[model samples]
Target: MGKILVIADQKDSAIATGRGLELAARLGYSVDVYAFVYAPLGRLKQTAAERNALKQRLLEDREAEVQARIDKLSREGQKVKLKVVWQKDVAPWVVGHCGKTAYEMVVKTGRRSESIANTSTDWQLLRECPAPVLIVAKKKWRRTQPVMAALDLSSRIAAKKQLNATILSQAIALAEAMDEQLHIICAVEVPTLLEDLDLIDSRSYVAEAKQAMAPHIKALARQFDLPLKAFVVKRGPVEKVITSQAASMRAQMVVMGTVGRKGVRAKLIGNTAERVLGQLKTDVLALKP
Candidate 1:
């Protein structure tokens, strides 16, 4: 029911619209995308006539992409609506808009370029965006590639607890739409404060954490109408456990929550979700709690 800000990367337009429109349809959210294009300084330094020619070329290119997308949607008989604003400096506007209006989530087509100095927008969004960010990879999802939803049962905030439910619900919707497997996982680690205590038993502690998580997991299962086996609680560093499980599951994407990078817990080691993003090759859907 809320707004969804989709920042299209324009890597593969068909793939972008396919993933974007699919998600919008699933959530029934009005899609507003800043269909961004990066023009190097050199390109803009040309003479007026040359720059006009370049502008024409860019316009034609964009029109072709839009037409192709329209054809695809027509063939598929999908009426998913999208409003696109062509923008150059993208990430700043996206972050700024989040403060202006509450966006439920942010969607994008591809990952940022590896070089931060050159292409840092998407990376910055991952760390700073107030809403959830869904970065869709180029490779279309396959039915066998599970959609992994990383759950943290230990977070006590009412907001975060509700966010876990939202993450799982969105993941379920994605899995159902794509007819893919849904893999739910939770990782447990001994609290650092408890290190001084002589009572630390990693296995027993992990077992108890899993036991404590059981009722919550079961409740999620009942709520989602999913089987208990779809959920798993494991022992390890949360980031490491998530990436490993996703790799083992051959996950196409991982859905997890964040509290932004400005929170106190985010200062010491950065958000675990960001670390997990670094380790994963699969697509990531980062939700905000």
Candidate 2:
């Protein structure tokens, strides 16, 4: 199996690393822990060489500290590697590394901001990282909890269709590996503006939306060999419905896809994955189409 890349933060608690190690141990994959560290800037009068020396010392210290923690937390007989890079921001480095390395997945702790307008490192990685990114939460996985896969069945776009398949495929693999149940979640988005203007009836619109999503949902369940009872179709905002269902079901993780929006488009439209992630208390496995 390929290695799983776990991004370590400067925080005392290595939540991502621990979760990644557990996942790796379960899936039989090795782990590569990358700890990005930075030293305080030297005084303006300080020589360049002195500043460089300080940075190197800081990197070495962080390396040792991370290594000790990894040694303590890593599973026995697991092939885990550690690399401490002297960089404060990790998104760029991790995105570049994923391009060069054949990691099965990239695991990182979700650093969410209060507002979706403000982007976090997880948002950056979700957009640019080539490999599948798993943003773990504070809550650990429970064996009985289901692994929920979110799909946009209303979208007829080829990319969305492909992404739905990818999301289900990953979720199925995870559920099987962890011996957990697999659940499917799709939100029926009713147009609020049209309904408000009396252009469309709210109840009829909801019925039509659910009806439109039926065949696709059935095909997916058959394709994945999942029972119909495991599927959840709800009406509301995508973010609200997914988060609510995950909470209600006590999902271990929610697997979904992001189109990898960038720049102004990302900020303006606000990626669904980003918004849902802001509210999710469970782990998320985000894939790119």
What TM-score do all the candidates reach, one by one?
Answer: 0.76, 0.92
Give the lowest summed-lDDT range of ten residues in model 1. Answer: 74-83
Please give, for residues 176-212, the per-residue lDDT of candidate 1 as tens digits: 8667889999889777567557568767787888888
The top-ranked prediction according to lDDT is: 2
Candidate 1 at 113: error in angstroms?
A: 6.5
Clashing pairs in 1: none
Per-residue lDDT tens digits of candidate 2, residues 1-289? 7799999856588888888998899889999999988756755568899888888888889888888889889978999998888776788989998999888899998877735466688999999999999998865436428889999898989888989988999899888898998888888877889878899888888898888888888888899887878778889988899999988888989999888999988888878888888788888888988
Backbone N/Cα/C clashes per model:
0, 0
Query: Which segments of candidate 2 are over 4 A away from where they belong?
Result: 40-49, 114-118, 139-144
